[model samples]
Target: MEDNFSNALLLMGVGLTTVFAVLFLIIGFGNLLIKAVNKYAPEEEKPKLQAADNKAVASIDPAVEQAIDLAVQQLTGGKGRAVKIQRL
Candidate 1:
């Protein structure tokens, strides 16, 4: 009975140690791969959107702006107000 108990404890210890060792190795390898990729494969620059000089920028209405401000204040229980209103 004593021998059986000792064997079971040894097996359990070995299994837990193996599991932790595998997790540690996986994390180490993942970090190494990430560093390699970041060093060799830097991000490319994306093109910025350009608007023509002649294109007219849309203006926001004062009445709509006031309404938005009022709604935001009410939504926040009179604690907040919209700082800027822009027409999409």
Candidate 2:
């Protein structure tokens, strides 16, 4: 009976230790990967022509716009409004 109790305690300690070790490794490796990527390949700004083109608005069908507005109002309990909608 004493041996069984000791064996159970040993297994529990080993299991908890293994779980914590794996978690620490995952967190450390993920942070290291993010840092390496950001250092080597930082974001670049869009070209001036593309940036200017983005400011121009295209025409939208009135019926489609109304449907989108109604959907947003119903979904958000009349609190949220659609700022932009794009087709995927």
Candidate 3:
């Protein structure tokens, strides 16, 4: 019984060590990959927004404008605003 218990404890220690070692290796490799990508590839710049394009909004009916604003608000969950509405 004593020998079996010792063997079990040894196996448990080895298994735990192996698991931690693999976890550390995975984290190290992941960090290395992220650093390599950031060093080699950078993000592109976004296009700048032009001036206000609200000329077409003035000709739209009041009810239509209200409906469009309501739709935009609903779709964006109240986080977005309808800045410019143009007829295509």
Candidate 4:
């Protein structure tokens, strides 16, 4: 009975030590990964300058715009006007 108790105590001590060591390693590795990410993360706001697209859809021409305005008046029960597509 004494031998069994000693063995159980030794096993418990070993298990606790192993758990602590693994926890410490995981925390250390996580800290290192976080530091590495912080060092190289994209913190700069580089503005994406879009090139001006002058291309207009051939189907949605000025004549279609006028038709759209008429359609909007009919669809929304005369509540709103169709959006004007002014060509720049």
Clashing pairs in 2: none
Structural similarity to truth (TM-score) of each candidate: 0.49, 0.49, 0.50, 0.45
lDDT of 4 by residue, 1-88 (tens): 9999999999999999999999999999999989998898744442332224435434356577667766877899866565544346
Please, what are the lDDT tens digits per residue for candidate 2 over residues 1-88?
A: 9999999999999999999999999999999989998999765442222222233313455577567766887999876666565543
**Regions of model 1 farther than 4 Å from truth:** 1-3, 52-88
Candidate 2 lDDT at 88 equals 36
Top-down lDDT ranking: 3, 1, 4, 2
Model 1, 10-86: lDDT tens digits are 99999999999999999999999999989997654422222233232135455775777779879998767676554
The Cα RMSD of model 2 versus the native structure comes to 11.1
Quantify all predictions' global Cα lDDT against the true fold. 0.70, 0.69, 0.74, 0.70
Best candidate per lDDT, number? 3
Candidate 3 lDDT tens digits, 14-68: 9999999999999999999899988887543422222245666566776886777
Listed per model in order, the count of residue pairs whose N, CA or C atoms clash below 3 Å is: 0, 0, 0, 0
The runs of at least 3 residues in candidate 4 whose Cα sits more than 4 Å from the true structure, single-residue gaps closed, are: 41-88
